[model samples]
Target: MILEIQNLHKVYNNGTHALKGVSFSVKEGEFLVVIGLSGSGKSTLLRSINRLIEPTSGTVRFLGKDITHIKGEELRKIKSQIGMVFQQFNLIKRRSVLSNVINGKLGSLGTFNSIIEKYSDEVYKEAYNCLDIVGIGDKAKVRSDSLSGGQQQRVAIARSLMQNPKLLLADEPVASLDPATSNSIMQYFERINKDFGTTVICNLHFLSLVRRYATRVIALKAGEIIYEGAPSDINEAWFKTIYGEEAEEVEIR
Candidate 1:
């Protein structure tokens, strides 16, 4: 297993218990999708894996190393091996696409050099290669905001790739795009997962997309895991269980 999470819990200052006692394991190279209703702690669970939102309790092991509470440079080293893509795309709108992608290496690049954007030739090449992997090498010099929503998300994926992460966490990556655009963006992630053998854990709203892209599916509700199985195994009864009886599954196709 590449990731092993045990009894993870998170509570906010407002007394909201986001994660009750989540536990799961991810094998290397699996495209794992997290499904849930709004406020189901899907985002919290993903963030906790990378320590973006520190878990209130429990343990996280990545590649057999405990990362539940590692600090300082130790954490940074681990972070460099994990990449995150967010719903908003999180690009510097005014910056060049190449600039945004190269920024993924900021953890490795010293603070002074990264802040000044004084990247070496090797760094530039790596950034360009990542953009190429996402099919945006030609857009390197363009400002990030000039691209369409799908394109911007692709840039975000490319940025994450510059970290050369073995694991990628995507939080509602295509939530803002149209269905067609969303599929295109997801295909890029598929390519990354297949070609590079990267383990992916993504939070998705649409079950259709989850079925299409995920090798394994995990459903969360009220901060607890309610379902864990193959995407094709989520039958009508299981769907209602995960989505609630009052809810209806809307087909994106």
Candidate 2:
């Protein structure tokens, strides 16, 4: 397994119980999609996995090592092997696209080199290669804030790829995109997952996209896993159970 979560729980200081004893395991190279409504703890679960939110309780094991409580260098080392893409592009707006992508490897570049922005030749090559993977190599010199939403998102994916991660976590990555752009963005993720053999754990709202891309699906409701199976098995009854009786499935395409 590439990732293992055992009884993971997260209760914010505001008394918001986000994740309630969630447990699951992800195999290497599996494209797993997490589905749920707003406030279902999907974001919390992804953030907790990367220790971004700091889970209140339970354990997270990545590559056979417990990383729930590790700090400083240990945590940094583990995080370097796991890349994350968020709903927002999260790029350095004023910087060039290539610069933004190169920042992904800053964690491993040592404090002095990163502070000086003294990237090596190999790093630049890799950044361009990553951009090419996302089909945005030609936009390397353009300002990030000047690109369209979809283009900026492509830059974000390229940035994440610079980590050479074994596992990639995407929290509603295509949420802000239109239907067509969303599909295109998803295709990039699919390509990365298939060609690079990277494990993917993505949070999504559209069942159509999930069924089209995911190898396995996990439905979350109020911080709990209501269903876990192949996307094809999410029948109408199961959909209502997962999304509530009043909820109707919405297709992206």
For residues 91-179, could you state the per-residue lDDT of candidate 1 as single tens digits?
Answer: 99999999999989988999888877788999999999999888889999999999999999999999999999999999999999999
Report clash pairs, candidate 2. Answer: none
Q: Write down the TM-score of every candidate.
A: 0.98, 0.98
- lDDT over C-alpha atoms for residue 155 of model 2: 95
- Taking the candidates one at a time, how many backbone clashes does each contain? 0, 0
CA lDDT for candidate 1 = 0.94
Error of 2 at 51 (Å): 0.8
Worst 10 residues of 2 by lDDT: 106-115
